[model samples]
Target chain A: MYFGGSFSRGDFLFLLSGAVTTLSITLVAVVIGTVLGVLFGLIRAGAPWWIGNTLGAVLDVFRSVPLLIQLVLFNSFNSMLKLNWPTFTVGCICLGIYASAFCTEIVRSGVGAVPQTTRRAARSLGLTWRQELTSITLPIATRIVFPSWIGLTLGVMKDTALVLWIGIVELLRSSQIVTSRVQEPLLILGITGLIYFVMSFPIARLGNQLEKKWGTQ
Target chain B: MDYEFQWRPVLRSLPEMLWGALQTIEIAGLAMMLGTVLAIFLALAKRSGKKYLSLPADMWIETARNTPALFQIYMLYFGLGSLGLQVGSYTALLLGITFNNAGYLAETFRGGFAAVPETQTRAARSLGLGAVQTQWHIVIPQMLRAVFHAMTNQMVWSVLMSSLGVIVGLTTDLTGVTQKLNVVTYRTFEYFFVAACLYYLISKAFTLSARVVAWRLFRY
Candidate 1:
């Protein structure tokens, strides 16, 4: 009613629910992605040259290619194979792997970024290799890579908008539905963008702050 | 044993896909060029120490860095269309990506510029170089090297971003053409799979070419 041409409060609620769905997808994907990434990254670091490079190349395809393409391809595959999973599940599967691909790189570089001398020092000090990793390399890498991980989480949140293509009505799609019915693309899209900005701004600011603070120390 | 993929239709459309990819590459390349140019100014403005100048730059950077690129493109195409603006789909996508690139590269440039020691600029000036020459001959080379990794990431990102053209009614980009083929042939997996490989190759080509260019030009 305030700035309206028949966009009801119910429409706004619908959008809010869509935002919730986006958050849910992001949360689950981040967890799954992080775990897979950590595991693969560790394996890649110690892996033989041929295996590591091949794995890296395969993962690179996921990272370099567009997520939109992956979504469409996978969704189609799902139907073709009669997997018949819901769109949400399919989205999560693709996004989880997508996040894992990038996360693996982050972890690899982070592990490499650990000073070799420090790792050697730890190894020389009567600690096992496992102890050296846990006590020395990993902690430092985790701290160093923490900011980027946050950035990745925020990225997954934004990428969730693409799921609309597969027919899951997250935030952007909700706005699309509203606009189609109510005929106010700018107003609705602006509101949707604002919602995204609000959700992301604080986290992004935190990432920047950490990058500075942790980077210096 | 499952849903058979009909690749014949997809194979027949290779020329169309190639043309669409050419368009996508053209937009991404232009956006990167323009975005880098704009980012230089924004980076300067942010460090210019004037609130009036930096405030607007800060807002542009923050809004762009925080929002999803899809919505930005959507607004440019659909949102503006509603207002009778009627921007072309290709142009709108280009503008949106350029806007994002400028905002992101501005931040990267700011850091890269800071990495260049202040003494170097003074040294260039003392050697009788003009302001423009100092920036071009001295500052930019070092800054580009410092930020080279980030620059390549954005270059690859621009290619990845071209896929968003589908939602914006772009029929000429690789993804757009693929989506059109998808709707008609219902060979969703086959078409998108080919499109995906094309995208992978294009993005790989960009990164690999960038590496070769850097190797040829950059030195220790």
Candidate 2:
């Protein structure tokens, strides 16, 4: 009724549900991306030269290419090989893997940003390499990288909109569907953009605050 | 045992893919150029220390930074069309990317400007240099040097985001062209794989050129 048409309460609910779906996809992908990224970061940061270099090269490919292209190619490869996975599942996996590339770099650089003297100081205290990393280096590095990690979280939340291309009915696609039905693209898309802005503003604000508080450390 | 990799289709489609790559570069280059100009103004607005100017710039930066590039492009392409403000896919995509780029680069430049202490500005004023003169002669060169790496990253991001043009009916970019070839040949893997390689090469080229430019500009 707001735009001189029958914009029902159900339409709002539909978009809300779509927002829930977007959050779910972002949550699932972030969890998977974090785990894979941590593993890759550890390897790239501390593993043997050959192992680290090989993993680095693979991650470089993923990071360099566009996520949209990766999603399309992965979806096609899955169907071509008769994998027949659901679109949502394929989207989650592709997005998780795509995000893992950036996360790996963030983690690697975070760890590198930790001072070498700190590591050596821990070692001279008779700490093992594992203890030196977990108790000393990683804690400091994680603190340093917290702002970047939050930035990445906001990024993944936004990138979830791309899953619409593969027919997953997330928030952006939900708006698109409504736009098609109601013939009010501007109103629908504006509301959708506002929804996204609402979803992301708090996280970005928190990132800024954290950077302000801990960045000087 | 029967699945053989064919380079013939890839070779046959090389010219088309190359043309597509050129289009990709063209759009990204133009968007970056436009974005940088807008970013300068936005950054200056944010630094202007007045509520009216800063507030709108802040909203634009925050909104553009928060939303996905795809959403921004979709609004411009589909949403604007339905509003009867139709534009070509190329213009829609270009405007969308430039908007996002301006938001991001404004933040980067703002940070760079902040890193230059207020003491320098006061000193410039004491030396009878006007505000614009101080900014141009002292702050901007240093800020550009500080943000050269960030600008390169944004360039890569612009190139990658251009791939989304395929979804918006852009058939002239690399991804768009690759999608067309894939439909004709049913060589989805080969075509997309080659396209990915082309993207990788483009990014690497940008990285290398960025380093060279940084060296030349910041040799001091």
Candidate 3:
């Protein structure tokens, strides 16, 4: 005599909707995160000692703490302020900024990988700082940083699953809901895990392949 | 005039939270140690060139790599429970972190093993050593040395994942304790903020100590 085994078609659709929400959140967050990260990365790279470290200390908090705690803290702060933003809005905002903290480091490292001699030579050739960044630095750094950026995108997708803690019905939460009614956790959770695997595995393999191809050249 | 924060509740329960942080470290340390042991076998299985050995290893590694940690925790706590195997919350959380650690460290070890030159294995095999003995003596040590930095990274990730114990119904861990406090006090910001700071401090301590250890060990 086993447990309740009533996983319906509607339950599967619910999980897919959750996966869709997860993808949307990742897309928005990456857009917001990568832009802020590039801007912050450039500043961190070019700025002086005092300013950069000061900025770093603030962003380090995001990198250090678990995403769950960050989500809870941000949600709490949101409610405390009486703004009453939708949970989805709050989730996207929190995840976007959380990703920026990591993206800043990636982009800064990307910028740092551009050889000083190369930058100096760009300057020595009468290119302004802006031109050097646009022409000499950005192009090379993009090639070096492309694979890492893809990894970050995948990371943000997985991290989006944490948004369910703040009451969003993302993939994990949706599966949890179905499992509650269906009484088959392994089946439901296995399907949820497969959804994430299907979503992530291709991108991860691409990143690895790109890393290998670019690394040798 | 709203949101007058109360820090007294958090202040009063500082001892409890501190204890919770200690448990967090305990989980992370235990998971990293056990995970490293598991990762060695998984890595070897992955490279064993035998279908039966490598296939399961590949599945474990890939499944763990692809899914969210929260889902993995759910699978252990709820999924396995449905199968009539009752794992305690703490045990589930511990195993979940260990599972994650082993999955990632397996990949790192595979790369590290590859980087060990074939001649070293040949030299060991020539010295009247069997295959397993050669791996244990020469190959594993070199692999560990090469992947030491990556292992330190996985150690810190184990710390971060320890925060998930609370969600899995273990109330003795840092995040769980903090959430418990918040449920009573309704001062979500205060309790979670403190928890967040503690997490940051723990991770920083891990990386700093790892750097010092590397400095000491790799000075040559």
lDDT for predicted candidate 1 compared with the true structure: 0.91
Over B47-73, each residue of candidate 3 has an lDDT whose tens digit, in order, gives 999999999999999988888887888
* lDDT (Cα, tens digit) per residue for candidate 2, span A1-217: 4444556687778888999999999999998899999889988998899999999999888878988888888998787778889999999999899888888988999999988888899999999998998899889989988899889888999999989988899999998777766778788888889898899998899999999999775
Which consecutive 10 residues in model 1 chain A have the weakest lDDT in total? Answer: A1-10
Candidates arranged by lDDT, highest first: 3, 1, 2
lDDT of 2 at A171: 96
Model 3: residues >4 Å from true position, as ranges? A1-5
The DockQ-derived docking category for candidate 2 is medium
Best by DockQ: 1
Better of 1 and 2 by TM-score: 1
What's candidate 1's DockQ score? Answer: 0.79
- The lowest-lDDT stretch of 10 consecutive residues in candidate 3 chain B is B211-220
Candidate 1 lDDT by residue in tens digits, B1-220: 4567678999899999999999889988999999999998899889889999999999989888888889889989988899999999888899999989999999999999999999999999999999889989999889999998899999999988878988878888999999998888888888888898999989989999999989988976
